[model samples]
Target: MKIRKLIRDNNYNEYLMDPIYSRLLENVNNLNERIFQKNKLVNLQAFMEGFTFYTSLNYRSTPIDVLPRIISSEFFFKISNYLSARSYVLNKFIREVYQESSTPIPDWIIKTTPYFRSEMIGFSPPKNIYIHVYGADIVRLRGIPFILEDNLRIPSGISYSYKAFEYLTRFLPELSEGYNVLKPNDLEYLYDILRYVSGSKDPTIVLLSDGNYNSAYFEHRFLSDKLGIILAEPNDILVKDKEVVVKTVDEGEVHVDVIYRRIEDLDYLTPGLVKAYLRGWVTIANAPGTGIADDKATFVWVPYLAERYGMKLESVVQPLTFCLYEKENLEKVIDQPTRYVIKKREGYGGIGLAIVKDDNLNILKEIFKEYENFIAQEVLDFDTVVSVVNDSFYETYADLRFFTYYDKVASAVLSRVGIVGSRVTNNSSGGMVKPLWIIQ
Candidate 1:
């Protein structure tokens, strides 16, 4: 409350020009000056609108505290390596899981964990390339950075970050001085890579959406526009004679090259579509039948897996520790709920999360039963800084989600931060986003 009071008095404008704000502003300007020397005057407002639109959904994010909890590169590198290793091991696990089970992946922790589909198994992606695009959240423990979660499933925020990166350069032109900010029109790269991987040099890429009703419709539009790809819904695409094709008005037909599907879950894939993917006529990014790998239960073993798959190279980063939210664990944690958090086994956006200290145990029990969730990640404690918001100060937790792409080459990373207080930390989950600076 005190911080909120201070932030409010300062006003958003003043906060924007504060040290951290100014640093971010300077970094963007300098990067643009060096990199985009040919293109003058970046669009900050448009970028902000993109950020606003995506983060306003279910994210409970507030303004980022002026002072970021910075992690050293050595530490950051460790985290990155860990993610890489985990991805490899998880890939192995997914293949095994699918091989063993005819049924859909279950919610059970141990049994299902060994073969996490979402983690990275079953289905052909670029074999030489690992995770093409990865978005992992980090929170500080004491002073060390810890990985929160990984978003390999249709990771969002690339459009937001690209827009924001340009916007910051324009809004704070004075900040540009030394650095070269790489221009990130990732959608084109994404389309190209998907096509390359699909083994079609010039395939017709399609952006699949559940419908306009989906929360991230804006992102679907953004990517489609950027890549010059066709946007189609399930109904718009039809399967005939074992091939997936898009049906156009006037009874026209369009063949697909590769599918950049934006639909969140496998259930959304038309029944015949999965068969089409299996036949390998139509290609999908990250491919289908890989959802279970990223499941929460499998997450607990990522560190161990890294050692096994990565040839004893420790995981680059460490994930927050996890525990089951059974009655026994809940009873011990009831008193210090804030010290721990309870999350559903299958959750996105803090949907069934219970911050015990902030709420109550009875409520926690109900959530546990209803969601069959996991419990107690030692609260990711980090230093808090003040953020000025609407003439008020709010302390918010900020974490970065980096998007990486792997084409014919090695893997790379793209990063963004979710605004605080939002469980999901996704732009669609009500997060306020800012561009991540790759400071030299």
Candidate 2:
């Protein structure tokens, strides 16, 4: 099969050559054929139907792979351990960034960054953690993985990853034969984090959302249901006398101790909630203004900040970034634009990116006018997985997004793949998300 060939022939997929992974791929291959053929649906129809069902699980419109990819427990643990150490460094780094005066980050960058929230200057959230939940995109070059970006701003997709694993396993129980495929960990500890932050043994925690229109609204609802917390909309949440409360169907004006926020805009956070949060009457999982660390320009300082804080990531390294704000860096990229990918500091969900491919001089010159808002980074010829879609195996570009709690350990991962002819693996685009199955 093409998947077997993928493992055998592709140098980047050398890890799949292991006997256990090979066997798992064979089972996935067999199952893919069965799932497609038995439906008697046309190829397009089959893929559409499968994707429809996947989205019905309430993930915002992203297709999933036909089968879960194999990851070793050892590798995952190693990644988690390394990430925890990195988190330790970042936590200290953030503390320094928010300081009134002394900081390693350039004052101009901090003051100019749109993501910087000044409201958080004096306040410290529970555990003094600004990044309560963190997510980072990881892409591999050759066979080695490096972090692509950080999502410290109320990161989404953990719930989606959990649901994907839950449903995929149920859909293909037989595939688990002779394999110890561990289920993804639950997010119940989020409530514990909430409670600890709130300084309440039984805090009234509510999952605050931007509502159903948001792409991660499903995550908001799913997490609320899973953690047994009330899911409150903006209108539903109220802050009175600096103590937050939520309107309820059964219990009117119920007091809320913690708000597990899903929205990023501080405006949506409501002035009353902000006041309550500042007063320590309520806790927001990620305090407002965490965007300081979340900014791309600030990301360039992570290595420096880590070193300055007397900690460094020992396991995985991140890509080298070139800030376009520098005239010399701009000249170098203009000299050879094709070697790097140009990205706007504020852009997310695969937007505001230029690959600088053939004959892209005009666009590059135009975008360069506002070079201060962009950064250029070396392009990675990242590794690809054999992603089976509609009973066909396509060597697909893939990346992993690891989600972690402030306690410094990665708890869940969402693996995403871009179907052939696509560059980005973000779910908001046409990419597919799936569970990264670990062999325990």
lDDT of each candidate versus the true structure: 0.53, 0.72
- Using TM-score, give the best candidate's number: 2
What are the models' TM-scores?
0.73, 0.90
**Cα lDDT over the full model 2:** 0.72
- Model 2, span 1-440: residue lDDT tens: 56676566777653463455666665766775675442233223324433322222453344666466667888788788877777677777777666544567777677778977677776666778777888888876765668888888787778757766765665667667778887776475566667787777888988888776677666777787778899988888877776788999998999888888887774754657776787888888787777777778877888887788777576677887868887899888888888887878887877767677623666586665788888787877787777657656667778888877875454467888876756577676678776677788
RMSD in Å for candidate 1, one decimal? 7.0
Task: Name the runs in model 1 displaced over 4 angstroms.
Answer: 1-44, 47-82, 99-107, 110-132, 141-143, 177-189, 248-251, 265-269, 311-320, 325-331, 367-372, 383-388, 391-395, 406-424
List per-candidate RMSD values in Å. 7.0, 3.5
